[model samples]
Target: MLSESSRPIIESTLQTIAERINDITVIFYRKMFEYHPELMDGMFSRADQAEGIQPRALAGSVPVFASYILANPDSYPDEMLARIAHKHASLGVTADQYEIVYKYLFAAIAENLGDACTPEIAEAWTEVYWLMADVLVKIEKGLYDGQKNDVIHSNFKLVSRKEAGTSVLDMIFEPADSTVMSDAVAGQYVTVIVKTEDGLRQPRQYTLLPSAQNQRRIAVKQNEDGEVSPMLHKLEVGDIIEISNPYGDVVLGGYSDQDSQPLYLFSAGIGIVPMVAFLAELKKNHSKRSVVAVHADSSSEAWPLREEYLKLVAELDDAKAISFLKDGEGDFQGEVRVESLDMPRLASVYMCGPLSYMQSVRSALVQQGIPGRNIQYEIFGPDQWILRATRRSMRGNRV
Candidate 1:
């Protein structure tokens, strides 16, 4: 619903904004930490700051905001927002902290844009920023409400930890106070907050492994490249880490008419986490649903929850697991190209993975004349590219 009248001005302003991304993010983070240092404990990783990952990620979100404002205002995807909510939820981030972020963000923009930002330009960008913040606020509000009645950090205790298949660690969280850990859908994840040796707090999200509702388990693969995952790998059985209530949009649909439609779930690497959760739900409800669950990993060693996924697919009469690489596997019968999807019969498609893979899958579906409403996916990183994609796609649709 982006108005034709304002679209040109919005796009023109965005060109300048995208160019000053690094400066904006750098100044914004500096000011944010200066005013609110406590947030640094759980939210921003010191290691990532030293290595420049957090700054780069924030810089990348600029274009994403532009694309969203310039294109379909009626629709905003929940994937990126959900990831942030879960990350924030893990560390118990609050609305007050988000307000702090907003102040620094706008202040930095004003400083960086300087005289080049005229009244119209300033107003337009302000509208865009508020719109983006509003979306985030609504999402954050949902997370707050969801966890309102739940206990914090005391229900689950770390039971055991061991390397599962190589990079992934199979860590079990047993109920300490309540035998009923919230029933986690297969594809959903939980945020684990651990106290680092430097006394800085760090949070990381991991996909839950298959288990009865009473026992909550997750596959913690060594994120050698990330700050929190490495710390997570070092934890022991008796160690207690704060667990956030599970929050994700990738869960199974409600028991409506839509539940019976043909469902296709796609995942790459750790993206398979949520897919497993969805499959488990499908079984418990005795769903007569038709599903095609596919996972792509480098090899069997990286195929997290291999046995569990296979077990669910086997029992479900209509489900199948399309594996890219098996045990000592060489190759597949055919490369898992998105172009091969039978879009006409598909009710909905859920996908999670690298952006390139999702983009390819999105393109394939769009090329086959599938409606945008039928396609869904998630991203774990900043989402400025989403705006770029929307702008390009909308312009192409008009032509």
Candidate 2:
């Protein structure tokens, strides 16, 4: 909750701060990285920093959070906070790091705002920052406590590697030590940490695919321009790597309580990773719910886990699968035509793909009278969904 004394101050200056938030964040990252260059080695992504995506995400989130708290002072944004906390837990973020971030973030704000940032304004913003930071710290602590082991990363030896689809490698790994492995739920992800040739450690998160209890499986799409995926693709069968415990809020069976509701799973290209896991879990449980699996790709040959995806759906009595291929044989051609599908408006939808693809599909669903709350999405990298949604809402209000 925001302090009563600071609420009016924040309300008065929020527009001014919001206008310069992007500039403030850019300065903040520059000053922080200049002072502590080691953060780039493992914790933060240099590519995202260079592209300015990280700063934009931070800039968008602070004002959104402030607005939310102002409107509803008794509660925080649980979904947004959980998503952030899960990602932080996967990367082993510590409470002390929040202090380091505060030092540079406020310094940037002071530097940018100049004479307009009075002592009272700075104090109010400080309270807001700490309030948000404290909530994240608490949530991350709970996630860490729920893990099977106290360590952030554990050694895993590669057991097998096979090509699942075009440019996608299916790798299986087993614990190299006696570290207890947590039971991973479907749709969760694990962070893989590897050392580059330059002796710098880089961490990347990959969704955990279905496998045996003692084995961990992940399908990695080799990104030619990525810092980590290329190295992951070159690993031999007997190689060792570090992996974090599985952590994600999106799961196969826990999103809603309506067990008999129609379930729709949508994916595109390498986004089929989590959809496959969800199908495998449902097959294992013999779920009788009405299930529709939809996928889109450039070609049927380019779809990762195509056969396995269809096979699982085939085994289920009340399930069916469809594909939309741009240049090859499928049930439909071109991009996903969500309007043409015969799905119930009340069905639960889980979508994973590129952000633009998901946004288009979501718009189609909304036009068909489907409730926005019924749809859930997972982003593979830094999430800008909330920021984008906030912009959309602001635009709608103006109209």
Candidate 3:
């Protein structure tokens, strides 16, 4: 909770701070990187920074956190904090790094606000920053403590690679060292670090694909212009790479209390990775729960892991698979039309895809009488969806 004196000060300055957040974040990154260039080599993505995605995400989150606290002073945003902590833990973020971020972030705020950044205003915003940071640090510590080992990363040797779809490579790997591997739940992800030709190591997170107990598998969607994916596509079977332990909160079978509730798994393009893992887990358990697996792609041939997806659904006792293809044979001829389907009551839903696609599906589901709390989603990159939703809710509540 914010101190009594700081609370009023934050309420007074939050609007001004929100208005200038984008500029503040832009300056913060520029100054931080200029002073500590080594952070760019592995800890941060140069591409996201250059494209301004990282800055915008930060700009969105701070104000949202402040606004939510003012509106509900008794509670913190646990869901948002948990999502962030999981990502931070996977990237090996430490408690000391928050102090470094605080220094640059506030300096940038002061620079952007100029004469308006009074001592009281600065102190209040500082309180907000640490309040959020402290919760994240605690959650990250818990995540680290639950791991099988204390190390941030482990070595994995590529065992085999094969084409799964149009531009996707399904690579399998085994532990290259004696490091203990934690059992990963369905719908979790791991960060893969690759050393580029420029002698710089870069990290990118990928969802763990379903595989045997002794092996780790991931499907890489080759981005010709991407710095990490293209390099990952060229690796040989004997090559070794660094991989982090799996960490994510969007696990299958965790949302609902009833084990018999119907489950809906929705995806688009490469977003099918996590959904496939969920289906495999259900099949392994021989679950009797009703299941609906839906996917959308440009064409039938463009879908990654299509055969495996269909086979898993078929092997289940009460599951069905549906596909919507724009240019090839499928159950539907165009994009997903959620209203056309007969959704079961009390169903739990999980969606992974582009932001626009998931947003549309979620809105349609809500309109069809599905409770908003029943649906959960995973974003492939820096989270922009939560920020958008928070802003929307705040706006609606304003007079």
**Per-residue alpha-carbon lDDT of model 2 for 156-227, expressed as tens digits?**
999999998899999999999999998899999998988998888888888999998888999999989988
Task: Work out the TM-score per prediction.
Answer: 0.81, 0.95, 0.96
Clashes of each: 7, 0, 0
A best-first ranking of the candidates according to their lDDT comes to 3, 2, 1
lDDT of 2 at 331: 92
Residues 1-399, candidate 1, lDDT per residue (tens digit)? 445655677778776787787778889888888988887776666766676666656545545655654555667545555555555555566667656766888788889988876777767766666666677777777766665345544456778776665587778887666533555555666767778777877665666767755567887767677777787778777776777666565555554424656777877776776677777778776767778887777787767777777798887868877766644372453345655545454467788777777777677777777676677776554444444544555574331
Regions of model 2 farther than 4 Å from truth: 255-258, 390-399
lDDT (Cα, tens digit) per residue for candidate 3, span 1-399: 878898888888888888888888888998888997887776787778888886788656777888888876777877778888998898899999888889999999999989988998988898999999999999999999998899888899999999999899999999999999988999999989988888887888899999888789999999888999999999999999999999998988564324767899999999999999999988888788889999999987889999999999999989999899998589998989998888965678999988889999999998888887788999887887877766666665532
Ranking by TM-score: 3, 2, 1
Looking at model 2, the pairs that clash are: none
Candidate 1 off by > 4 Å: 1-12, 46-87, 118-124, 148-155, 175-183, 254-260, 326-335, 338-347, 364-372, 381-399
RMSD of 2: 2.1
